[model samples]
Target: MEVVSSVRTPLITGGKTVGDVTQDICVRVEAKPPKSWFLAMAISLTFLFVGLYAVFTTAWEGIGVWGLNKTVGWAWDITNFVWWVGIGHAGTLISAILLLFRQKWRMSINRAAEAMTIFAVICALFFPFIHMGRLWLGFYWVMPLPNTFGSLWVNFNSPLLWDVFAISTYFTVSLVFWYIGLIPDFATIRDRAKNKVSAVIYGALSFGWVGSAKDWSRYESVSLILAGLATPLVLSVHTIVSFDFATSIIPGWHTTIFPPYFVSGAVFSGFAMVLTLLLITRKVYKLEDYISVQHIEFMNIIIIVTGSIVGIAYLTELFIAWYSGVPAEQYAFLNRATGPYWWAYATMMTCNVVTPQLFWFKKIRTSLWATFFLSIIVNIGMWFERFVIIVTSLHRDFLPSSWAMFYPTFYDVGDYLFTFGIFFTFFFLFAKFFPVINMAEVKSIIKSTSTSDKALK
Candidate 1:
């Protein structure tokens, strides 16, 4: 079927055995934290504290501190919220969808990808909460709770309410799926723990996974069941997120193509994020054998597919608007390409549309440096995609008096940095404690991920 590639490549390069896989992955847990890791942690913490100050400033004053005016009410924060949610899509796709298809290459990458899903969702959740401005006081107002103050029962049809449902459900399922995958690897760490403190911690996390035939049977059953449950979520959660705009009366956002378009773009950005993280991790941990060049190439190919889909969606939106003879819709897209924010639109097109096409040549896709750079570019473009849809649509209206250009304050920039801080800090912590690669899964596929041609045949 040529699932990933027609010309086969080794999934794992080193002639590693079962024990080698365990040792390679578990050592990251048991060993002393590297100086480089600590240095990286310090930098992330610096960003965290700066972002904390920004949060305090916002809470102390109000969302008024942001550059949000009447016209461009939903600017950077909403853009960031949607961006992070989309960034999270690849993890579940890799962990669930690929697993369902029984793809062999997903084993090494799925564990880290799943963790990325959980963390990215947490980051996404922050925007709406903080954007509420008094969430700490009346966040419960979002729920279906009975109120003593008035007859209000929360708008059942509000798009934000759909966001509440979507983010919560998506977060829960992805967390469970991630933790479930970690159990077997956690058990492996427990068995190897020389220190009592470490052993106890890993033991509790393992949930008494004994790796027996019965245990394996049950494990397989539960994993498959979870995968089945999660597969629909990978589609539904993002569709609901797209509903936040698709349901809107705004010119740029009012379109039928949002659901599928959003899903593909989510996968696109998610895979790019996974590659960005994985490439750095591979270099730092000397894990080139497991997360091989072939792995990078496979992912780059997916970037190509999804990136192409996004480009087509861009054109489709323009065509639909023009063909429908809707002046507002037509201007919305035209203003995007040739208006005050034309640079943003150009950047989106270049990064999301043109950049990924370079991967049609195998060399660019296979090159580690090239993959890392393009992955980052794709994410930037996707962020701008959301920004364009939100800000450009709202910045100028049918009423010229309502027209205003949105400029982000330090609060907006800082809040975005805050998510980055939280994401990397947690990721480094996760890398230190958890097996970034699924040792048990990789061991099960040891014979399959071989480097030698003889093994392939």
Candidate 2:
């Protein structure tokens, strides 16, 4: 009996050989980054600088530079923070949660998603740091040291402190998780590298991986443990983010439904961002053979399911607000639908609630252009969701006297633009430097395809 090597391509597939698929995927890395890449990089960098300038000018001036006032203390800055954090959640969900379920389709797109998570978290971190008004002493919030002159202690009970802890932990864990997965793939690149500079950099990052049996064994074990640890942390981080609102005494913010609602919304929005990136990347890298229509369809199912859950949460909040007869909560919900920001609220409902329902159609879900446009719509809706939640809830609190409308000033808009600038800048850089797809995981999938073919024969 001859033992089949899993690493080899199959002899036949629909009368076409497996070599064709491998050639389609592996050949593109040989080509230089297109002129379009430089164009995108230049554009993203310019936006990034403008964003930075906005942040710096605002920090030097004060929160007064923005449209935020006493009633709506947290406006665009907090909305942008929560939105970016929610966007970060999908990467860990794909890399860690799906891995535990043994979803092999994730292999092709997880790398890019994980990179997106890291960049999104970086964008999220910016708002909180600068929103402090006094950036130099912002570390005082979490330094864990007793204040000598002011007798101030970091409020352990405060949800804001909890957010600090939660966001930092999430960022660190995501970075580690992403880098560990990259090591072996980096080693593969190092082996294939022709230039001394490329070889040295990739070789250093690979941590001298030789692909020994023992090394693979340990690597697999560590990956499993990390995935297990990260799954709960991913769920918890967003829950805690919701707590930043729920734990507040504000009527709209103080709800028990927030944790699950936020998690679902996070996953929904995160998947949208993932779909947006993967759609472009698969085409740019000519990786459709690996990141197939099946993968896109599976992700669409997740988007629909999560989107429906989020829509239900929205309705449930309205029902609870009315049924409870809590005047403040009722007012909050009413104001969202019929208040100064009503247009934003309706936009949220239309984009997040109505648009994603179209994915129930197989034709819509599988069509790349349809999915791409829907992904953009989902992101827009998600942003509006955060805005509605933050602004609507806080803008008009219990006392009618304190009620006021909030709009983003130039500084506030700057904060948002910079956040996008940073996110796209990191993403563009990732595209140029790294293996946007995990070569090892893709190789394994290719090997599995070969085995499935042989078994069929």
Candidate 3:
């Protein structure tokens, strides 16, 4: 038995061979889902139908059905948009950023993460479209198309328009990158397909992948190129989203730190989401050996660092508000921490900042149960972080006379649930119908796991 050395520790465990990797991942797609999967699907579909009903009612009755008023026009719609967009970032980072850094740990997690990224962006896109009262016209109107009305075009200066381009580009790139990575795995599934339907679908998706040395050579080259393209692209997506607020003259929204702060928060929430989804996924699918404790520990470390950065950003906002001596900014910060919605502020502080700090302990970071709960807490804190930024800023501006409180209606809650439905529906389908793990990439690392085991011996 020849021993192979690796740069870092092994990613796979259980002494899996290449054949074992293919059989393990492919059988997941070929078999019927467990009873738990159906229960989850039923729950997801209930939310989905509820969301659809809300969307239909909103369309029939108009945007007035929800909680939008003159002062707090954005409310939950934009907050959910930013939150979903932030959640999408971790997927791209897991796939592209880690790939660029040549981190083998990413190989175990990136496929599912990339799928999560695509689904999350899909959820984020719903708000802007649904926010338009006349969604029919608003859809094409937002695009920079040559129209019969001469020289009429979208505002190039608007960050909202920039978001349109940024998100669309990010989605396109992520989709292509994810699909490209899936080709080899898809081919693996195609080869092992027992039925004609599975064979044809997987064959078409694989694009005639033959597993030649030349084919693999090109595959690696393409993956590397795409990773380079996606690295800055993911960062830019969230940064542009932050610009939607930072470019505003609103007292709390106008901050120079918005870009990096938003990016860190996005990555932080994204990792929390990945942890939440993957923890359940690995256990449900019996993939603990592939996704292992070491991988969880490393992701926990990222959450700790990014969570700390977010906490610092919170304090920095307070310091800058007071240091500037701008009365409106000062009052905005004060209102956030002590206003009618102070509970939201407190929740954000506790969840986003304080909770993730537990990862600093080895015991907490490595514990699957602990990581699962903290991941959910981090997302909740992140949601509040967005809510605090959007609603708190808009509800009270420079004018004392224009001040008002924001509240979400049943429809608002429904649309938020809709995103969850969209996310989980797509995720469960992907898990069952496709290779959740990247078989080819994991195969390359099988020997690395063996080498590490030998070293321990």
277: Cα error in model 1, Å: 0.3
Clashes of each: 0, 0, 0
User: Which of the two, 1 or 3, has more TM-score?
Assistant: 3
Per-model TM values vs. the true structure:
0.96, 0.93, 0.97
Please list the residue runs of candidate 3 whose C-alpha ends up more than 4 Å from where it truly belongs after superposition: 1-9, 149-151, 451-457
lDDT tens readout by residue for model 1, 1-457: 2133347665777777778899999999999988889998999999999998998898889999999998888999999999999999999999999999998789989999989988999999999989988858546767787778444798988887988887898899989888888899999999999999999999999999988999899889988999999999889988999999999899999999999999999999999999999998898899988998878888888899999999999999989989999889889989999999999999999999999999999989989888989999999999999998899999998799989999899999998998899999999999898999999889877765565333444
Candidate 1 residue pairs in clash (backbone atoms < 3 Å): none
Which ten-residue region of model 2 has the weakest summed lDDT?
Answer: 8-17
List lDDT for all candidates, in order. 0.90, 0.85, 0.91
Q: Spell out the clash pairs found in candidate 2.
A: none
Residue-wise lDDT of candidate 3 within 339-360, one digit each (tens)? 9889999999999988899999
Q: Model 2 — TM-score against the truth?
A: 0.93
Ten-residue segment with the worst summed lDDT in candidate 1? 1-10
Q: Which candidate comes out best when scored by lDDT?
A: 3
What ranking of all candidate models by lDDT puts the best one first?
3, 1, 2
> Is 2 or 3 the stronger prediction by lDDT?
3
Off by over 4 Å in 1: 1-8, 149-151, 451-457
